[model samples]
Target: MPPTPPEPAAVLARPHTAELTGWGRTAPTASDVRRPTSATELQRALPNGSPRGLLARGLGRGYGDCAQNSGGTVVETTDVDAFTIHDADPASDTVLVTAEAGASIDRLLHALVPQGLFVPVTPGTRYVTVGGAIAADIHGKNHHRKGSWCQHVTSLHLQLADGEVVEIGPDRDPELFWATAGGMGLTGVVLDATFACPRIGSSRLLVDTDRAADLDEVLELMASGDHAYDYSVAWIDLMAGGRATGRSVLTRGRFATAEEAAPAAGPDPYAYSAGVLASAPPFVPDGLLNKLTVRAFNELWFRKAPVRRRDELQTIPTFFHPLDMVGGWNRIYGPQGFLQWQFVIPFGAEATLRRIIEELSASGCTSFLAVLKAFGEADPAPLSFPAPGWTLALDIPAGVRGLGPLLDRLDELVVAEGGRVYLAKDSRVRPELVPQMYPRLDEWRAVRNRVDPQRRIRSDLSRRLGL
Candidate 1:
């Protein structure tokens, strides 16, 4: 017998499945998924009323529910992907590129690199969208030098809750612009954005590697060596205790010139192949990724990189995203989807970091990947996460029962240090602590009130944090 298909107006609640936090999972909810092919269609689809319940979603790469709507309409922006490049002055070394809010950064980078241009800032993964980047105010390895992704933005096309399209820039609607940069889509629906792309010599990177004995050594090395390189990141051994605690392998790099790149052996000069996308079939057993296993992996990683290197030509993926090479890698943490905890502690809060690491180690919830980096100056975005401080990020499986309390303790430590948590990657932080971490919350709310006066825009994150 032939099965009947759902009608266009059928109100159905299904088990929604998509990638959130790198591990693809399903959340049971009543969400009307709408894919709008054009701006007009998008405007027409938004519910027409005050205090509307709605959310905009991009590539769904956020490690938490920042993009998810519990029982509201989820507007999938992927179909709105369209891009154009304008006449950019080479003398100024700036290229104006415009893309629909849903345009994938990875695709945009692939197009721009051929013209000797690159995105001013990119998160760890390139699968995110221009809108997502702006909503999160994402920073990159070069944040110490270039600042957050919002800094490169020139203009934005935003659709208000009442379905009015408005153009905004730094000089025009400056307050709304600043608020929307990290407003998490609470201000309005981003339709498109314009950014100035940075000119690069070549697609390859000239990388240097170094190893540090402990957390203190890693900080000193980064502070001393940061000026020499435009990009710097460290992989910390979270399980290492005592003298070896916070042992890390640091890699620093910059774009390479034609002379620096190896000679092209074939006709296709820039043909770099990426690995196929794969997913974990099912969850693995709990405790699959413990201290012992992670310790061994860290030891091997630290020993593998060449020590005190001057330069090495590597592909963008190898230099920027080494983890992308391994498909279904998240399965290493088992079926319990992992929670990524990324927090920043101010410059004088070294004790906070040490305490967090010690707590994680003692709790026996050591993460498989622990990253440490030094952030530079702060931007004006009220809800933006980055600041002048030291940041640490980790991935722990959700099945760890006591993990929530441990993270809460860490959050307290972070707040005491005058640091804040990255809302994009958070899942379980207390709502009360949110206001403490982000002092400008009220300012951001004011802007939201002006734009979405009825408080129409909403997401799971907003509901959870009482934003």
Candidate 2:
């Protein structure tokens, strides 16, 4: 008997007026949030002629306004939950999977890890959706080995402005494919995509840990030793000063073998578990994350690391998504929210990196979550953020007395050094500086013009950066 056709998507829920903000919780904007359960409904909800256009929003994990549209329509894609995992062939090293735009990485890991499979690339958190990963072209600690997220993507199904669905891939529609890879949803709404996942021996990582005395030592250590491991990252102590400024704890690792995990993590080596341990109470007083408090936290964290350690078994969640253990952790920054400033300077620009760190330390900026990593190669996606360079990410409390000016100065330094900020984490970058930071901006715009001729798909970040 023929399989009955799936029911057509129901009429999308009416747009509701709601105040929306990114994960950073900064620059909240009012927009009509439209709940679309499927691709057909999403196409119906597209604002073709409305003064304020439509933007597709995933799990709202983006740190900035790239997924938001002020005074416009925001189509919530959470309901578009289509996911399927194909049985892997006995001879293959990869697993094939198909997922809708709204399926979060957390969901994928839960389904695949037990089967000895894992995503090719993942950011600091697994709450991000597959579509968000592609749109942002996010990289992970393994960027020095595997490229960005889109590198492993086989193809994507996109819904264009005219309500037409098209299949695009690197070879099929090279121009459009590259444009939308890191286009930040400006091109159209991503419906679904197929990607390859590598099989893993276990869910735990076998890690080596080391502590660096200062900035130069840390850089030298990472450069000299990172290639020996599949993944690498460094937790920097921004509050330290004098000889200790830029001190860091470096960790490098790969998936642990079954034998390695049995001795350390118990018998069920493939078992995966993650959950919120606590929640931050809302309405906390402002200035709760003052310099003194953050400095103390940084010191305690730095001092806790082992001077030198090797092959410590750590669960996937503990190693990759530590922050996810606490629900609503962002609230700890207080009501004013925070800004995640992430920028990348090319290999030879280490001097600029040192200068920025010195300025931040001197300015007494409080950032307890500062991290530094090295990127290997860049993909062809015009707007993709990663490159062969050093990338630093800092979480700063918003509305700091001189933060705006300080960030502006940092932007200047980055641009002068031929570096660029990650749009997925940026809320306040100058429009003129974008083109300089991303030399291929014109190419991406040309593709956007062809697909969204009427400029129907837009976002706050698009307008702010003049993309």
Candidate 3:
């Protein structure tokens, strides 16, 4: 007798075959991909799920495997994208925007910025969907003023593994709400989210640029002065050594008032352009980003900035997301891909932070992208990445010598200092260290297991970390 095939409902869920990778271009996984238009449609496929389980993918902006479910069902929410903005109350400095699971920040910003509104918190790239932001609980350059993405979220609709739909928020089903905030989309699939967006007078920012001589000076400058700005980030030249080690270009700013804006904003002050100036070549040879090239690039980048430029008007894209200006920028690293390490150590563990930076510099690994930021108060989500600390994020090509063992050693150092790497950006952390890094893992999983008793929702990251 021939075995029975899945019904149309199940077949619809597993629409097609595809190989998916994260933004890092690392670790490709095969899956049965589906783009369900609505939650009801998505729920119909829940019963016939495979033992390998299922996972929901947003815009695929995550740098690692958190969004990947190998040999399983991967539901895409791009078609489900839709959003509605309620009336704004500038008096209260609040605007409520509700977006579907797939509505991207870029599209939302295009609509909202014209209305003098801006997301309270946005990751480096705006192409990420609202659901992705909620899942990752992303933070922006303005952590000192704002916080993680979930902090501004008032409420959300989540569909559990058993096909049950529930609305969760800070005050409603608070446990599940916080769990899903930074649970890496493991708790459930986010259907919709209503979060607070602040009123911005213009799309331009009043930026202040300062060049820090070295690691200590930059740390001191950010520790003492970050509070004065709504947005702050320091770009470190990782290739520099000795007195120049950790030399940085610190840029800080707040939204420009209508009067402070310049002509660059065009006739309309709130106008925004999400344009890509160039695209990386399809085939870049490996080792193109070696030490000698990176060193030269870093030198040019550092020299381009003014010593102490204050109140220089710049557009949102230039200030917040310079990498977004180039499409497929990850391909520049070539086939093996790259690793982005983002870890936050408590303020008291500055010594560990310095030691880690020094090790990376001395390791002969070539890297141009390194940034440091100061975190504010912690998010309510137990799985949330940020806390009161100093976070450093850097990119290194995978082909570099001693990369794996080096990161592994660095992980031990970070864990010893009571710090943890961002799971959203992680692809290679050891399973045993996960619990040690996130003490509330069991608490988060308890809530997750209740919703997904069989653990039907799983991703490569969940499996890797034994979540």
Candidate 4:
């Protein structure tokens, strides 16, 4: 049985704690945080009245302010962790799994993969929570072949802003269902969800790697080869110039069958570390990752990953999330941290991409990690960010002068080319441009207002963008 809810007054006056965005590191602020271990406690902590204000926070993996609230209450959902394998249909080759929103995808996969099952979708990092993944409608390398995470979700147990706990799915409250998928927690707090899991043969990924001479070559490879693999992604050397400008290394992979699988030799599957469990030191020297250092790193990475080859016996973590193994890795960007800029431009806007890449090169703002991927069909969610196009993601340190203005210019270019930024990783998109990027903004707002008439659902991002 779950524990009883805590009294609302008991949580008042409690110290506010900020998240790991590192934004608060240089200038710290606080919020009244509630870490409820059960749904009863969750209900008790919600604000009272017609529109109860609250925000949900997972692992704090969101790059910007999406998971944060300034003065309002924040419900830390990490305590609601639980996972149950409902059924495994051997004949149908599908697995039905139910997990509390707080369960981390990495932890869940460690357990599922050994049993020959895998989540249908996963972001670049497995550290994200199931609830966070759904709220953001995250897309993986396989997005070209599969849709966003919402496409696999069978049902969601949500706690509405008004304190009503409801079960919503395709068959029930379909509008609320789609809205909550990419809703960014504006609709309600996700309690738990059930989704379909794909069957896997082994823990290894059969990978095919190749190098592209430029952005155009990268796109051509993806367009021609994406269907042959379950997962595909390209790492761009943003600093490369002239004929080698936008040079990239593309990797495509699929689950290895028993006949192709190698022997496992590592820590027991269930005992793997939770990942980067510690934060970076309070202060880091500035200019630690400036142009010179970044350019050198880019050269090494591109040269190391040869032109074309096949690599066998690849571990799951090395293939899907190489960054997770390094603890306190964000510190590499120094104390100011970094901003991940990810935007997608439609297929016909090749010229727009060329212009954006040219600007980055001219400015010498070489992103250490620049990834390019192709997006397939668009999701139905009003706020979903993916579509049939090419998406580029770059991690830029925040301390650079004129960085904000450059981003604003890029935003203009994106808007002009019919592109949109990912809200989960954004902190600076203009409010007016948001409606333009998301045509269904008003529709989502209507659904949100209907559920929380007083506009209780709020967050730093929501308040900043007027969502």
Local accuracy of candidate 1 as per-residue lDDT tens digits, 1-467 = 78887763442222243333323232324455676777677676565422337778898777778887765677878778899988866687789999998898788877887777788898777778998999999999999998898888999988888788889988889899999898888888999999988888777888888888888888999988898898998988887778888888898999887666646313333445445456545557767677778778877877786667778777777777667666666666666667788999888888878888888877877677588999988888899989999999888878777777888888888998889899998888899999999999999998898888876788878988999
Q: State residue 380's C-alpha deviation in candidate 2, in Å.
A: 0.6
Clash pairs, model 2 backbone:
none
Q: Compute each candidate's TM-score over C-alphas.
A: 0.92, 0.96, 0.95, 0.92
For model 1 the TM-score comes to: 0.92
Give the alpha carbon lDDT tens digit for every residue of 355-445 in model 3: 8989888887898859999999898898999998999998888777689899999999999999999999998898999999999999998
Q: Could you report the Cα RMSD, in angstroms, for every candidate shown?
A: 3.3, 5.2, 4.5, 4.8
lDDT (0 to 1) per candidate: 0.80, 0.89, 0.89, 0.81
- Name the better of 1 and 2 by lDDT: 2
For candidate 2, write residues 256-367 as lDDT tens digits: 9888888876877788987778888877788989988998898888889999999999999989988998888888888888889999999999889999998898888888
Positional deviation of residue 17's Cα in model 2 after best superposition, in angstroms? 0.9
Clashing pairs in 1: 283-335, 284-335
Better of 1 and 2 by TM-score: 2
Error (Å) of candidate 2 at residue 395 is 0.5
